[model samples]
Target: MAKSTSGLSRKRMGEMYRTMLRIRRFEETADDMYMAGKVVGGVHVSIGQEACSAGVCAALREDDAVLTTHRGHGHSIAKGTRLPEMLAELMGKVTGLCRSKGGSMHIADVSKGHYGAHSIVGANMPMAAGIGLAYQLEGKDRVAVVFFGDGASNNGAFHEAMNLCAIWKLPVVFFCENNQYAVSVPAEYSTSVDDISVRSKGYDAPGLTVDGMDVAAVYEASREAVAHARRGLGPSLVEAKTYRFFGHSRGDPHYGMYRTKEEWEGWKGRDPLIVCEKMLKMTAKQKKAHADAVETEIREAIEFAENSPEPEESVALEDIFA
Candidate 1:
């Protein structure tokens, strides 16, 4: 689908494209399944923010821990979480990542350094600090990345964790996906600063805000932040300015409720997948081929989930407590 490029090899660029597309297709299908009652619980799809997760995780190693928010499927997939396990978790199958317990808002695979995801806004913030502290005390070079939204930045944990990580020089990359809204509330209405990354200045940490729609841009910026942390330079805040094509959640209106049609249309023009294709100069045939592969993978995941067994009623409460 791509030819060799100078900055990033054509192969890696193509991989990123496919990853973004994978996220888009996966979320879309998951949402559909949720509505159809095949999938359990509330589904929050990161359809338009694929570039943010794809690019940031591309800059990370498998051993680096990732702590993400409720809308975390994109980040989990980006970290190489298996599609079957993810779907199983969504479907509440025993073969799921968290053994049918965590579901969509809570999935964790420690073997791959994906610590866990939280439904509470900003909940992962302090956990990111704790994980970073653990790595520091252990003298491990591995870093922790906490993916939060613009809403979480306003949470108290954001301030505490950022301050503590900065003061201690902990290895952490604070990745913020500022998608313009926190539920139905506009970020402009709730946030005091125009750019959330600017808040990093208060803690004397390196901060950068990039275009979340451009996978290449997000990757480059994330690589820089990751490098700074690996060098024991402490936490770095990397914010991606992006948008979500879907509503805040299920039953939420896609338009006329909070976002203007013009705003949504403008963002749609720069959809991450479209941007990736344009940048790579992929042919229509190549685009169609990539899409087919993504669809096939997703279908297989669903099939596996449906066929998998559910957790036994006997052991359902066994893993409830730590």
Candidate 2:
């Protein structure tokens, strides 16, 4: 492994590797649970793209706000949400975040500064701007980070929010996890631009593209973006070129449906976990021990979620305003 030019401490690099491993293991467990019918509804696992969430969130402070899309379990975990509660929420149990109302798509922990994950396409972009506005009005140094997909980047909301954020000099970072496909459609077919970061030019903000499979690359880019926002330099766009190992959702037959096995294997070859492990120069034994520790933690989370009681049927109507 070459010496890290990113200047990250050995401890921090190890921590990043552990964090990515946790996200990978958690999503793998969730996929198994979903297949076994334990987790109801659909789940959008961020399997291969864990580095984006973990690296970006690593650059954020505890008080910094984050808004993510439906495929957000990784982002939630990276942003400091409790694993057990998040799993319980996915299971629709009473002990879950939002008391089981939000389910997988809407998991949130305001205390952790994660506003919530949205199911609507591109909905949170403007909301992130609003959160940044609130922080600005409050005269705080906090910044808002919004994660969206390549598909959402084409939506009007993304453009509108970026314009607003740029004009107002709002402290926000628009992190686009461009995993190639917007559901069944590839970015090549759906998007006009090669890199989503190019859209920032129209809004008069800085734009950067990073190799999302490299955790160190993502962390460095995010650190710069976060610093730019915190310094009141306004918003910036970071487009992470990555891939999702799973289907658009758990139900989709990812292979041969829209993508090929060869393509899948190509991305898997660049798996962030593998990349980081090589960078850290972890021995086989050390890798196994690290993986074992993450597995144990995930097992505990699964147990906690299983042991939790289901939400009462009647209470579903209670939390609703309409």
Question: Which residue pairs does candidate 1 place in steric collision?
Answer: none
What is candidate 2's lDDT per residue for 130-225, written digit by digit as tens?
A: 999999999999999999999999999999999999999999999999999999999999999999998999999999999999889899889999
**What is model 1's C-alpha RMSD?**
2.8
lDDT of 1 by residue, 1-322 (tens): 1112229877888999999989888898889889889887778899899999999999999999998878999998999888989999998899999888778999888888998889999989999999999999999898999999999999999999999999999999999999999999999999999899999999999888888888888998888899999999999998899999999888787778999999999999999999889888999999999999998999999899999998899766686678
Show where candidate 1 strays beyond 4 Å: 1-6
Candidate lDDT scores, in order, read 0.90, 0.91
Worst 10 residues of 1 by lDDT: 1-10
TM-score of 1: 0.96
Best-performing candidate as measured by lDDT = 2
Error of 2 at 23 (Å): 0.7
Worst 10 residues of 2 by lDDT: 1-10
